[model samples]
Target: MIIFMQLRVNVTEFCIDFNCMKIPSSLLGFFNEIGAASRFVSRYFQEVVQPRYEVKQFIKQCFLIGYRSLPLIGITGFIMGLVLTMQLRPTLIAYGVVSKLPVMVSLAIVREIGPVISALIFAGKISSSMGAELGSMKVTEQIDAMEVSGTNPFKYLVVTRVLAATLMLPVLSVLSDAIGLYGSYLGVNIRDHTSLSLYFFEVFNTLKFGDVLPAIIKTFFFGFAIGIIGCYKGYNSSKGTEGVGRAANSAVVISSLMVFIIDLITVQITDVLGLN
Candidate 1:
């Protein structure tokens, strides 16, 4: 009877542990989502390389994604530079490094703030837009129509948008940097009389290939992440109208998160390489 009791106890404990070790539905859902996204990425890569290049669509996407986005990007970049300069001036004065203001502002903008802020803005606008647009198409069965019509929907839609985003962001980032520097110049002059040439001279003098190249390189990843996530969410959207809104919202959130993660990784890499 004692031996029978021991066996029962052992069996109970083993059952308890097995139950404990089993994944909860919530965590399992999360893992399943991650796996789904991974597969989506793989599908994108596979579809992207296959022929029947959508050149016209790609150009249209570039114009829409790049040119149309400029005004917002420029305005935000200007304000960012101006606000940063105004905020930093007094602190620099306190430290007796007021003359170094241009250099400091430029470095901050170029190395980190510019790419990140620009990407977030781009993600907010573009990611959500892509998600909504694609989600709507998905819900309406336009993709299915295209498929039945013997058209390559993925290439025509996803590849063009993704490539446009990947290429355009770096250009947009460069423009934003330049505009921000101009705003910084104006900001510097607002408090004290600093010549345009002098402010730019100070800014350009301090920045090196190291600071600029890494920043540019990271923006490409930022763009790619933003585009891929947006397209993935949109292309895979389901559940009708409600899912469209969810896709747009999630795309913005995920892409913004990706931008920060990529930036952190880039900073770490540059540090390890002594670029910083």
Candidate 2:
């Protein structure tokens, strides 16, 4: 009986030890992922700012990531504006603020929706693409070859992609804002006719420099966050094809979350500054 009881106690201890190991293991895994990503981004910034910049590659990536991404972003922008207007019509009409719709809608789009939505679209297209491309390069030994050749693979690949994304996202957001506003016009005209001049006048009239600048400025950070996170994930991807998918997935997830987080802080700062 004493031996049997001792055996049972040993088994119970084993089970408890097994369960306890999983919690720490899971926690460690999470922290490892965070640390790896943070280090990669820091490395990217350092490499990107160094001399001997890769201008040609940067331009090539711009065309690839930015130009190639326009079609999807434009469509999304149009739909976003049109849908927002459609959805808000009933609310505005009920409140008898239908005539105020142009300025209201424009403010909503420009001050908030335009940058955030555009960034999200950019995160989906540019970030994921950058991650997958770099991940594939990493897994296929292209990155290793560059390293073997004494070419700074991080600078060549990561910097180029991040810089392209940083520059292009602001430009893309500007275009999206314009397109979305136009969509808002169409939304307005569906119920009542308003000239472009009047629509824009009301828009500009309601908007202050404060409203415009902060929104635009935050987009730059958004772009940078997306680019760095995506490239870091891909550049450090594991030595297998599966790593490509993981990098791309992680890029989108991290960048999207970062956008919202940054946007929240931006809004708070802007509000504290009394822009609203």
Candidate 3:
């Protein structure tokens, strides 16, 4: 009983001291923002599974956010493969292991580089765009009008966009990996005489189901991070036009950060699973 009372006293004293201390405004704001975001995500899950699915809006978002973004992803993937191949060639040649070049480049691209780079690009483009578009709608009071009219704006706007992003990113990342491999093939031919069939033969031999699945799995997470953060930031935007700009800027930053965090988590999981 005495020990328990002493422990309670310590807790009460700590609470008193904590309340008495002057916390920095910036630190308080940071925690307040985190709490707000957590609430937003909780609301999302609650709303996502409810009835009346927005199929048409989801399709439209897929076309706009996914299909429209393909060319940029493809080009980036190609350049990534080409540059990587060129850079690795000299080192491999010096070690007299140039034969391992195709295997090395393909493993690197398919395993880590492609998914990450594509997701970063997606975050930069899609996240910022969602934030700005929704922020503007909020600023213009269109969201309020929708609510007044008994229209489900969150369902129409946030749900469809987030679902589209979650589904499309894996598809885009797979395509990027393929395109990067092709670019690597061309780069191989630039300095060395490697047949298309031979190059891919080596690449396919190096890549296995275990190697590819983890990379693809992480991309779904990356997309969710990009979509949810963007939607949350924009849906809650304030301060009119200034808030819209801040929402867009912060969405990109946060989405990009989330992608890296997810990727790191995936790597740790995969390593534990012996998929590394």
Best-matching candidate per lDDT: 3
Clashes of 2: 0
**Residue-wise C-alpha lDDT for candidate 1, range 1-276, written one tens digit per residue:** 334445545555655677777646575455556666776677778888888889999999999999999999999999999999999999999999999999899999999999999999999989999999999999999999999999988888999999899999999999999999999999988979988988888898999999999999999999999999999999999999999999999999999999999999999999999999
Q: Between candidates 1 and 3, which one is better according to lDDT?
A: 3
Candidate 2's C-alpha runs over 4 A off are 1-23
Worst 10 residues of 1 by lDDT: 1-10
Global lDDT scores for all candidate models? 0.91, 0.85, 0.92
Pairwise TM-score winner, candidates 2 and 3 = 3
Question: Model 2: per-residue lDDT, tens digit, 148-201?
Answer: 998888888888888888888888888888898888888888888889899888
Q: Tell me how candidate 2 scores on lDDT.
A: 0.85
What tens-digit string does per-residue lDDT give for candidate 3 at 1-276? 334445545545555578667566575566557666766776778778998888899999999999999999999999999999999999999999999999999999999999999999999999999999999999999999998998799998999999899999999999999999999999999988989999999999999998999999999999999999999899999999999999999999999999999999999999999999
Q: Which candidate model has the greater TM-score, 1 or 2?
A: 1
What is the lDDT for 4 in model 2? Answer: 42
